[model samples]
Target chain A: MIYMKRVRLFLVLGLIGLIPIMISGCLGSKTSIQALFTVSPDKQVIPFTANFDGTLSYDEAGRIVSYTWNFGDGTTGQGPVVAHMYKRNGAYKVKLTVIDSRGRTSVSSITVQALNPPPTAQFSYSPKSKLNDKYVVGASEWITFDASKSTDDGTIVSYNWNFGDDTVGTGKIVKHRYIWPGTYNVVLTVTDNNGGKTSYTQQVNILGGPPCNSDISGGDTTINGSQK
Target chain B: MKGLAAVVVLVVLMQVSAIAGGVGLFAGAGPGGAALGEINQAITLYNRLLDNFNHTPTITGNVPPIPKMGSGITYQAGEQFWITDDLALGGKIEYFRTSVATAGEYQSGGKKTPISIALDCSTIGFVLTSGFNFLHYGFTLGVHGGVGYYYSGFTSNITFSVPSGYNKTISVHPHTGKGHYNNRSLGLEVGLSMVYPVTTWLALGVDASYRALTAPRLVDAHGIGLDLDGDGTAEHINLSGISLQVNVSIKLDLFR
Candidate 1:
């Protein structure tokens, strides 16, 4: 009975020692391979086409690994020798994360820009259509002006009309009445959505009642005279 | 996912280590009667220090009501009393100053004249506290009770200037009034904390306490500067409400 009890105690101690060894061996098989974090040249710009080359290896023990790249443009890609192209222009922080066989990971970050050409604006006014050659002063008349013939690559948001009489309005079509007989310069100014503007002017004349007819009578002789 | 998993693993490891360390250290040290007596003595000393805080004379007040209350700051203060080794009760006195000036709205007067209203209130209160040490694990739990008398005063003044065409200074009682009444009210307090021993006689603790005060109805009669429809007094006045107290106290162990 004494021998059996001693054997039992020895078995318990032996099992206790073996448990840690077994766990250590199982964990050792995982082999912590520290990730290789790298970026080529450390800098570049967008339209950004760059080659990514990072080789992850083992710490004396061989382990397979994977790489993930965050372009920081709300986009992510993966591979070892990854090729990337940035579409927009701005400074972007790029991140590279590597994971080893045991699911351990390491990350690196770099800032780069997307190079792009400066934006341009181009514009031209619509061809002007004639409204009548002459109209009496103080007479109201319909003057149809077409402002849609204008074109701008950027975008045209508004049109301002200077009716030549110091009266101005905004829109494609406007009706104007001249209260005085005078030669006035009518200007149509159109502006693009980008704030780029171009103006065109037209000469308009207001005739004063056929040169003001008058009648003259001297003793029995009557003559009709008109002031031009 | 990887970062998150790493964090989770670290936290699990830290928790396991803390539990293991605690059990190991306690078992190895084993309990000695003399050591237990020393701990008891320390607790007694801590409670005695707490008892030294005998009377909580308190003063608290709110800014004048309405527009003034929104723009002004409220202040409160309390005095503490030590009732027992594990309990400390005190009374508090508080004062509040809130002022409203019509200077901005009535830059030029017709009906638009300068008026200033300031409502001040004060309270004297009582408080109760209970404390206990947490088995060397460095934690304390406590409950609090408080009661007080609240007083309020609402003062409104109007200074009007005659129109440019007329030469006269008109003084009228717009709403310059005083409301003085005393009401007995009760307040409840609660707090929880963790205490860490810095030395044999010194300790550091972090605690958050809250006090809620309920009082009688006090009218806040200050509002719109002009009585547009030709009414003698301006309208749209309301009553004042209850207040809450929150404090983070850094305590010093004044004695062993």
Candidate 2:
């Protein structure tokens, strides 16, 4: 009788030990569903002046999550905020999807565009090398022209009006066209590839004739010079 | 008695004739000188060989096997003799305390018992050996070998503790157990001792040897003990095993 009673008591204790485990297993399945996924910047289109801040979030009880960013390029990307590069211009798309613990899913997306930038511009001027010396009114002189050495590394090549006078033009050279002349300043204006422009002016004196003359006799030979 | 006497006289006469014959074999002065030179050469060769043998250390080949079954270590004491000039010899005796640790585990039908024993053995021995110190190049070496009787034994006290207490403790009385279980063993000993003389007579010498024990193995009889303290107990006995003796001696060379 004692042996039988001991066996029964041992079985009862074993069963008592298993009760809490079964109860906890049943309660574990009823937790609330949660969503999980992310948004890189949280907000939409990022401005060049402004940076984009993105984030990722997921429902605690959710599963089967994915990300797709439209970047507005008609191209699509998947997997988180993943990657983004903004160099020149245009809008980008940012998307996020989260599945809840119950297998339900939700998606969020935003567009980001890059700002446009201004074009750069620069200018340079050149003068005719052929006529480098002073000119005189009603007087004519001949000189060689060279403009090959002048250059602007970044500016665009453009031409404007050339004022014909004793003033030398700083623009690409043409044949000299001076009629009445005096000490006159020469001016040149050039626009660069980006539309930036600058002008330069310089002065040269024009005289009608030589200022003095002299007669010389040597070895029975005579030479004569004249001045205006 | 008369026949025996005749035999002895004949032997003596024969020996005398042999000696005379030897002397006459090279009697001419010229021949005698040559023979004398040859004798001298032979003597030199013998002396050189003797010196070489004496200068070299010797070792022994056979060692007696003695089982030391106790917690205390066992050791050996020994001696080597090198007889050369004027008879010289060296002796040494050593005591070694053996390691005293033993363990055994046995299991029987789901029951196990582990047993352990330990002993610490330390050894100390000394050598007082000498021999004919042959002089060569300001150094001396001796050639010696002799026969001697050797004996050794051991003792140990053991107490058994029974933790189970069926019998908690047992007291063992000391006893004088084995008497020279193997009495005196005749051993042939050979040794060579080389001495680098730091002085005319005082020299630092080392000897090596080969010794062979002829009969009655001593180490085999060590299991008996003695009750020297008279507490009526005896533990272990007669455990001297084959021992190799190598010794260095400070020699007082008889003749410079």
Candidate 3:
């Protein structure tokens, strides 16, 4: 009988030990709010905008009233669902805070690896054949445009050129003749393998006529080497 | 170790029966300084590796206490034979040991991973020594030198979660390895001693010695040497040390 009483006392003590856990669980459920969110478009580059959804988050015994987002780059927003765009290359810890009708709040966070920087676009232009004091192109001389110096982590596809002379051409090296002597903005656009594009621009001076004594026409000025 | 004891006993018996002037069994204990160059290097290398690991951009946690191994105690047991009134020869076995350990954990990403590393080592030497005696003012002073056969045992332990250094960050993974690794080498020593013979059959003495012994490399039972530093070359185990001991000697003729 003493052994059985001792067993009963042990069982009573074990039950007493569980009282705190049970009470805490009961108190916790009244204010428990589970905050969950999801983000998509796992791979991104500069200027990437991601969609964050928190509508699936719910409270155990109440309803969520407000959803606040911390975009991790010193920026924030409010909504059950929203879109956030990162202007830089970095890993962002996107956090969300959900508050229930009773003012109970719960927070959830996720880290995202975002943004591959855009490729740098660069090019140098020179007058084909003879040069006058360098960088000085004859009005009708074929200009050699080289974009080979352009670099990127990915391959550079499609080199687009705008001669600013009402004439445009494609290819890494294109030749163009200015119909009249003038200064014009020349732009080179390089598209990378990631389908992202960057452009470089420089002013070109075309010399024609006057005391400079330049006799050249804008016609039949196709460059040698088949324009590559 | 038992075999060594047996060899010493048989040698003692043979000497005692063959015109022995004196035969004595002696034991001593003292502090010893070990020159464990390779083992120390391994410890340093392990710490540097851990520091590099924890320095990674994504890894973080409690950096456990570092591991250490320094000088330790040594015990000696031997039998000596007096070849002449002025010279004595002896055979002995010595054991020396040292080590330290630590345990902790590190967290990477969402997982908390336990981490630990421990190191310990020991060496047993079988040596034959010869001492010359000269009496001055009733105190005997002698110079001694000996050759020894040494065996060294080393152990390494490393524990941590894998799938780490996710980007080929840590070059050398200091992993848990064989519980024991061992190798053997020859040793040589030279020292000085002073003794006072009491009653013509008993004596007390003090000896100071310096030993040079290197096991070259230690390997597990499968003959695999460890390159804990990832230096591509196996570590060199140096057992060299210096020690001072006080001993007692009882002449065998008293028993005869």
Which candidate's TM-score is highest? 3
Residue range A160-218, candidate 2, lDDT tens digits: 32333523333343333233335545444555454445554444344454323312110
Q: Between 2 and 3, whose TM-score is larger?
A: 3
Stretches of candidate 3 off by over 4 Å are: A1-228, B1-19, B50-61, B64-70, B108-110, B135-138, B160-168, B196-202, B254-256
- Write down the lDDT that model 1 would get: 0.40
Write the residue-wise lDDT of candidate 1 on A1-228 in tens digits: 575455446544644554453333223221233333334433443355755554432233335477788877898888866667776656677777777666676565556655433223222222323357433232232345556666665566676777676567666654454545577677777776645567877766654432233222111111121111
> Per-prediction TM-score, please?
0.24, 0.23, 0.47
Cα error of candidate 2 at position B253, Å: 6.6
TM-score of 1: 0.24
What does candidate 3's lDDT look like per residue over B124-233, in tens digits?
Answer: 99988666665466878876666788888888776644334334322234446436789988877666778777767777888777766767678888887866654455
Stronger candidate by lDDT (1 vs 3):
3
Query: How close to the true structure is residue A155 of candidate 3, measured as C-alpha lDDT?
Result: 84
TM-score of chain B of 3: 0.79
Docking band of candidate 1 = incorrect
Backbone clashes in candidate 2 total: 78
Best by lDDT: 3
